[model samples]
Target: MAVLVVLLGGASVAARLDDSSSDSAFPGRPDDAASAPLGAPAAGGTASDAYAFIATQKGGSDPVTYDPCAPIHLVVDARTIVDGGMKLLEQALDEVSEASGLQLVVDGLTDDEAPEGDAVTGPDRTWLPVTVTWSDPKASPKLKGDVAGYAGSSSIERDGHRWFVTGTVVLDGPQLKRILDQRGGRAGVRSVMMHELAHLVGLDHVDAAGQLMRPSGDESITTWGAGDRTGLAAVGSGRCIPY
Candidate 1:
């Protein structure tokens, strides 16, 4: 069975969200000419820089990544979202899209509950779009305590290659609301969203203090650092999968 790799945020940790789920029946690649990459990753950034991947290919450092040929669609659950939260999300997505060279589109809002496991299919047995939901500690235990948010992608092995198909990003509504009420809260909210989205795209936490991928949240660092950019570019440049 294909396993679900869940990369956590608000801390440096990686855990298997599910191991028994079967992803073998998911949909295959489209048959049309849309198989070509939507865009190429922004050039620059050296591998020698400070950066890390959430999961690397077996016996290799190549990060497991989404299919660059297709757009990564996201759906938001704004029920618990605070004012200006959606705007920050849009800004963060735009920044990540530019740095990674991947096309990300928000498919509007969803009524689906926050995902708690590795199941990637909706009621129709098709792959679900990346879900971005505002949640609380009671609803999502992973968001308990000081954790602000987390994101992870689920990948499946096919034709001897791994490709990320779908994922989820869960934000702590209360924690973020408190941050938004304080000074420089918007920057803080954007930083948290960007950090989690970085995880969604395969970037892992680093020890560098000034980098946005650092383990802890720091509102002072509003943009992706050098290492973060290097990692984003690498993951975004992953080999395109036609199937």
Candidate 2:
């Protein structure tokens, strides 16, 4: 298994962004066919636009992705959500879901805090629901500087195929507050959420200036760009895993 972390920095702030991946040993498991895909990708973008995947299957071009047949269960930490934040979060997720054709169900709010590191499994070794939470530098060292958010998923390789099981998205509480206070700040906040959620589903930062998946955030670009849509469609249309 391997865990991939994608970092997103504040749009106005100059910050370095990078992707990191770490390997873990897990017993191999069998694979089986799954039911039909829950939905199909929404039409968007030409193939020439810029887009990238965070990770790809070894020796293959297919991006590691979540199962299309299963709903991606999500839980939010209510303690960190700002005023009106929950509505914005829901809206952002809806956009991602529509673009990717993946069903994302918000299980509900949780008392649990964000994990300090990338371990998708709990102490009992079961996969955790995709977690959305807010944290500060004191709590998460990774959000220390201009970093606005972080998102990633852990995947297990089974019979030469890889599928994302679970992931996390952590936003900077204080920085988000500042963003919310700015003109058109609500849109800005939603853009950040959408960007991080995009990362959660396997989209990577592109060098294109206008795209939401660009390395740095931009309050003005509230919606997905052409390449962003294309990538979302690719990831959301992945093979269904019945494991």
Candidate 3:
């Protein structure tokens, strides 16, 4: 199975964005690292020829997806801006939205923290705007290791469909900030943001190198590849749901 979770320490592993939802956890699957390289693809591999989408399970089952036709509102944790600020995040969001044809709205900053083990509450808890935050090792134990970020959403059984209502994205602030200061700068930060956002919208990691969904910190590949664009197109093409 193609891993849908982000990379941790260059290892293909699952990371959860929904701390409170049991279904949000990464499903048990074998690692695909051995099947593909973990670096940039061969030279001259254009997006048209290089990207790969997240894979789905076999048998008759509804693929987990967010309705691309609907507006996806997001709120960023104020502290996450210390590295490169919201500008980079916004840039990546725009790029992904354009590629996936999903409507994205920045709902402003929030003090609502993340990496929590409790359930989401308040008016926003019912599933509206997705939350993006920067977490220290204490807040996100996964970051204490090689995992740079975590992105996933919570769904509900409604209208006989499992609709994704809310999601959370947690980044390794210090690590990402350090990378931002390196040569890659904005592009590097944006790629990481895009990778997590990809997961937020139901994209899983791929073993192939160069795709934005690859579970590695390799900065050589700065944008989405061919497979990435294809997968994003599918994710964004999901059926619409009433607001």
Tell me how far the alpha carbon of residue 51 in candidate 2 is from the true structure, in angstroms, after superposition: 0.8
What does candidate 2's lDDT look like per residue over 149-207, in tens digits? 88887775556677787888888888788788787888888888999998888988898
lDDT of 1 by residue, 24-113 (tens): 464656442156778776666554477788888867878888788888889999878989988999999988888898888898999977
lDDT of each residue in 1-243, candidate 3, tens digit only? 111223442111122235425543322212221222122112332344333333332343444555544467789886645555688888988878877777667979888664344233334334446888877668678777667787777654433444454678888787677777777567877888888888877677776766878777477777887777776766666554433
- For model 2, the stretches where C-alpha displacement exceeds 4 angstroms are 1-34, 115-126
Q: If ranked by lDDT, best first, what sequence of candidates would result?
A: 1, 2, 3
Off by over 4 Å in 3: 1-62, 115-126
Comparison by lDDT, 1 against 2, better one = 1
Model 3 scores a TM of 0.72
Instruction: Assess the local accuracy of residue 212 in candidate 1 as a C-alpha lDDT between 0 and 100.
Output: 84
What are the root-mean-square deviations of the candidates from the true structure over C-alphas? 6.5, 8.1, 10.8
Identify the leading candidate in terms of TM-score: 1
Please tell me which predicted candidate would have the highest lDDT against the true structure.
1
Ranking by TM-score: 1, 2, 3
**Of candidates 2 and 1, the better by TM-score:** 1
